[model samples]
Target: QQPVQSPQAVILREGEDAVINCSSSKALYSVHWYRQKHGEAPVFLMILLKGGEQKGHEKISASFNEKKQQSSLYLTASQLSYSGTYFCGTEMAGSARQLTFGSGTQLTVLP
Candidate 1:
């Protein structure tokens, strides 16, 4: 099943911080984060695997909890360039290994 993200939309000012969450009903094998700007394809952000290490880029970071089957994206000191729609793609065990993305989280960063 596709994971569900909370706070469908987020409006932030420059230098602000925001967190987006994703949860699944089944056990997760991996969680992938991506961001897509208008008129562009989604760009890979990072991926978290069960019992694997977490990763971060710039001021963005993410964590995945295998026990809870949940993941969270943390954007710190947000910038105007960070404005985009974020998606979380999840992989579940015993599945086809296909990734199913959450609806999306619309994030707008204002100056």
Candidate 2:
């Protein structure tokens, strides 16, 4: 099953930081995080594997909770460029590479 993200929408000012969490009930093969601006396809951020691996792009960092089957994406020092929707997709164990996705968390950055 896809993980659920908290705080469906977060209102933030410039320089603020927020956390988006994705959690699943089933065992996960990997967790992938993506960000999408309105009306566009999601942009991949990072992937976390079972071996305690982490990846990032720009200022975004994500972590995988192997024991809990969860992942969290951290957005630091918010920017106007950071405004968008964030989604976490989970790859099921013994399943194909394609991920089952969570309903996205909408993020808004305010000046």
Candidate 3:
């Protein structure tokens, strides 16, 4: 099943912070985060495995909760370049390389 993302849209100022959540009703093997800008393909951000490891790059980070079958993406000290649509893709157990993506969460960072 496709995961559900909360706060469909977010408007933030530079240096602010925001969180985007994704949850699935069924069990998930992994969760992937992607960002897509207008007229560009989605770019992979990071992935969290069932072990519930928290992964981060720069000011962006994500955490996975295996028990809750949920994941959250955190944007810290947001920058104007952070504006984009964020998508969470879920992979089910036994499903290799296949992912079910959520509708997406639009994030806008203003100066």
Candidate 1 lDDT over residue span 1-111, tens digit each: 778998799999999999999999988889999999999999999999998457799999999888888899999999999999999999988778899999999999999
* Regions of model 1 farther than 4 Å from truth: none
Name the best candidate (by TM-score). Answer: 3
TM-score of 2: 0.93
In model 3, what lDDT does residue 74 have?
A: 97
Relative to the unseen true structure, what is the C-alpha lDDT of residue 75 in candidate 3, on a scale of 0 to 100?
Answer: 98
Give TM-scores for every candidate, taking all chains together and pairing residue i with residue i. Answer: 0.95, 0.93, 0.98
Please tell me which model should have the higher TM-score, number 1 or number 3: 3
Name the lDDT of candidate 3: 0.96
Stretches > 4 Å off in candidate 3: none
* lDDT-best of 1 and 2: 1
Candidate 3's residue-wise lDDT over 18-51, tens digit each? Answer: 9999999989999999999999999999999999
In terms of lDDT, model 2 sits at 0.87
By TM-score, the better pick of 2 and 3 is 3
lDDT of predicted model 1 = 0.93
Model 1 pairs in collision = none
Q: CA lDDT, every prediction?
A: 0.93, 0.87, 0.96
